[model samples]
Target: MEFSSWPQVPMINQKNYYTEFLKRDDQILALRLQQDERLNARKKAAVDIDRARAQAAQEGLPFLEPDPDLDEDEAMNDDDIDNYGSKTIVINVGSQNMRLGLATDALPKTVPMVIAKKAARSEAEDSEPRPKRVKLDEDAPSEEWFGEDFAREYNAMAQDFRTSRRGNKRRVLPNSRELVIKWNSTTPPERIPEHSDPLRIDWTELPANPAKAPDYIVGSAALRLPEKSKPRYQLYWPLRHGWLNEKEYDNRNMLERDFFLILEESIKNELGLTHKKDWNQYSCVFIVPDLYEKAFVTKVLDELIRDFGFQRVCFIQESLAATFGAGYGAACIIDMGAQKTSISCVEDGMVIEESRVNLKYGGYDVTETFAKMMLFDRLNYADFNLMRRHDFLLAEELKEGFTTMSDENITVQTYDFHLRASGQETRKYTFKIYDEGMLAPLGYFRPTIFDHSKKLIGRHKLIPRSVDLYNGHPNDPLSPAQLAVIAYVNQTIPSAVMPAPAKPARLMPTPMVSTPSKQRLLGLPAHLNGDKDATPLSSPAASPPAEDAGTPHPTGEDANGDEVGDLKGAQPDTEVMDRTVPIMPLEQAILTSIHHGSGADERRRREFMGSIMLIGGASKTPNLGPYLEMRLRAAVPQYPKEILVASPPRELDPAMLVWKGGSVFGKLRMTNDSWIGALEYDRLGARILNYKCLWHW
Candidate 1:
């Protein structure tokens, strides 16, 4: 969603604040660790008692009672405070990954925001039900998988299938029951099947309602599927381009429901909470992209407060939170995510709305580039159309590895691929990627090396001019470097000289356009309403795709199943193996932001350059720090060769930095002045956020 202008804090001695904040955080972490040890000890003691009782029952001997001092209930009650019951939790929902934790914890627990669906079992397990447990929601699907658990399982299954098959065909047993699937609709699954055997069937039509019986697996359990049963399953990326709105799903509403459920499941599992009711005791903060629509933010807030039972909930802009986490007051932030890269200038701890740039070029683009190089160039695998999720994942792994190496020439040979053609012979080949092949990911920085007919270079100007408001000609002229220093000082010192007052406010204000309630459900732009051919927001087929699925998609195929990967026969002479998309190099993005700041005050351009901070998952690319420093030195020859190109601490992952910032914000000591209590939210609704969060901008 859009970031509102935040209230500026008095410019303090930042060096002292940073040191004190770190010291307090370390103390909190140390206390948390102590609590964890106590909990573990209690658990171990309980397990020992259970074991002793079982032995006594078997041998017909008297069981020894547990020590009275070791009573768990008493021990828990005796503690000064229960950290587990604490309401302060921070959640960073990235386009590709999620990081979550209590405010006191030193680091957030992270998981890839990938969910894989598995085929539902025909029957539930026949076990004695606990009467105290809450009944399942009849309308909702009971079984689902999510996050790292799902990724692990899906990867294992894909790997097993690759290792078990010969000539892209599994050896079928004669007596095994055939499990053929009959489709209810004409549209085939996105993935074409490799085996025709019934046991390895694609999808079987079922009489069950689509909402009640989901078709796919969510967590790591999807990988445990029997080898013969693997073909029946098709992995669905609910979040394709970083949103939870997969338009490909046959039931779009069902997909959205699953997304929320998966998110809730992650929270519950991570916190070790047993019941949804327990959520009422906690206050939660969600950090999301600034590009999110108001409608999406409203929907999420409503769901979290009403359905999820959170005591209090708040939202923070990702980059702003990252600014806090990185301990920067005013710095240009380049958040390189999975499907999007956002560059924004923060002046006086506020995001420069006019300078914010979001581009659909990120880690996935790099993965796709590396994948194409491996398939079409390195291995010469002709059937590029056959590539699936696994191929790109392997490419991404290699891409990360290559980014770390200093060698000009590198070899990647472990991955093997089996290309299959229906009713034709299967060809198997292994990738032996060399230097040229490894150059694919370098496109992230050097887009000039790739085709530019699509104008991938200029889509989102990495360097944009400051809006007229930020521009101010000094009353007294000064040198460029001196001006830059003055600008830096002006930004840092709250008591700095103020600009001359503008005209008084008008008596009558312009009326604001209020969006219709119905129009707010779908997170679409308001401009769509006037377009004659604009897709209806209500159309299930036009629903947006989910955002944070980090998995790579099959590139050649279009949404309507068109084959667009014809390299030889296509009229264009240049056979660019991958799609062309604009990407602002991190170095270029920083310099442009600096230039914009320099326009406002020339002296602070160096300050901004010296405090360049990188956040987001893509920022984790090995050598990114050094590479950006080098590129910045080259881009602006006048700037000092030695400039700070900093990131979060080495122990703190860049991807989780925003979440850590949220954790800091959620702390009562930090956010007492800003938090909108649960009662306030209930009293004012989403409108309260605009006022309380200072999001009016």
Candidate 2:
């Protein structure tokens, strides 16, 4: 495979290409929305027709029955399919987002995995007088959880009433309040009332039954909650890193059912399949991480069959699907996603699972780091509690801006954080991002400077003591903490809390509350905390808090009442601490993944590493292909490795490469007899997936 022999690359400007991609994606999304509206209208019309027929029959007049072929007619109402080509709905659900639609299109419909809730309280319930400023007791479950530590000052927990059971609802609490209080630090809202924290929300009353609340809001709409209404609308991430959060969902025994409903709705509403009367009308190809256990896979398929009545369902490895999408026979894939970056070695379309490397850092970590950097150095704000979703989104914008820009020191972007205190005039703070600020996000590529290994703790240590490991369930094989640990170690924690690696890795120093210090990264200028010429301190840990308000100190002390120090004698390197984020450098992560499998043949390894396929939204950074090629070429041990990076055709989006590959795999021509039908699943069970899917030898 010579460079000249590779497929011709499409000539398109990166900016134009992505802009057009987003535009086309918006069009597809609009179609999906229309389909949902049409579905609702049809349902209402059907109900009305039934009622009219009954009334006419009672009046001793002729009654006309509704059309028997109404569903089929509505299903074919999609006139756009004729022009765009009908496609088998392909679905790829990641922790951060869900990609749905037919494979023949340029891009799949994307929806964020975030869910929001608005309690539909009756007028009577809303008029009920609220409890006045009640202080939470220390022992009243207020101090039981890490998030609960801030509960006393702000209402961390509140109840919302519902009078109906029609919409989505999940059991959150055991008491009569029946509130599903969700607190997400990942996408915190931009503003808060005088007495509230980011996670604080008031009880909402719904018109539905008092026993149930409204199901949560899903997709991008979740981000659009009014600033003032944030306290009333609870947001949750049903899927986190790659799987369901057991702590939040598993105990309810509704995890599988909820996932089924969510995916079903996504397929019908987001993919414009609302016309399909039943799941049997369409075959589904599900893409999941290779690390998923068989039991989980079977459970998923079982629900899809029993609940949704899908006629056919087949599961495939994400790496394999990505390889097929890239049109590569063998390649090492660097999937830079929202929460985790996975480096996988795929040879001839078969994934080498043992050689795969899962890093705890990804796009979200970059945004988080950049946000902290903005708060600590660029802006004068010191109260981290005031940091809102608006700030996080701005940080994300800056990161994307810098990644696309050519200049090193140029201004990336600017955003204003608006603050309005009690009885005070609204204040606006404008923050400008520079290329130096990009260093925080740049840590993902070169992580030595932002190593946060100290944050890695044994999984059992994350829980509050109040949670009983066992609640009198004698058949329980493992405690909740232990199950969480298993999920954590396997890189499946929904909240993206990565478990510690077996081997320790080195990282660069990121000190919080230390004296201003300048540090450079690979010739790039490092901006100290508002200091132009300060030198890196010999020990950032031993350095006292530079200023109380500006440079706030995180939990840096040990049980001995001394500052927590790292192996290198600096402040503990941990993501939990402010400004310090842990990430394995891209180069190291790739190389480590390449050499991980002892059984890998030299030729297979060489071919896989020789051509690297970069996919995912994070891989959209400008010049990434050339930069990686240069890095690979300059490596000391480079041999049989004229590294060539291949992205999706310029006309196609790198962010959609995986889903595209799934589209390719789902094609009837490509997989004529591979899918497991409902009958097969019923007879053979989950092992049917292993037998049907292309196995990694």
Model 1 per-residue lDDT at 6: 81
How accurate locally, in lDDT, is each candidate?
A: 0.48, 0.50
TM-score of 1: 0.53
C-alpha displacement of 279 in model 2, angstroms? 2.3
**lDDT by residue for model 1 over 8-51, one digit each (tens)?**
66788867754455355234433344355567876887798899
lDDT per residue as tens, model 2, 1-697: 6669768978898666544553542344333443555678678777988899889989989987757665533433346433223445677887778898875666789887766555443212343111111232322332232233223212211211111111224332233221111111122335445454343322233434523534665666555443334234544565544545443442435555555556776776776667545556766777877555444566777877767676677677777788788777778888888866767787766777545655556776565555444432323333332123333344566667654312333333454455543233344455444333434545565543332333333211222112112321111111111121222222221222344456533333334322212222221111112234533212224344333212222222111112233222233233222122223457645654564431225566567566788888877777677667665554523353556777765556777878888877776332234566666667667556545666621
Model 1 is weakest, by summed lDDT over 10 consecutive residues, at: 569-578
Q: lDDT, candidate 1, residue 125?
A: 17
lDDT of candidate 1 at residue 573, scale 0 to 100: 10
Error of 1 at 130 (Å): 46
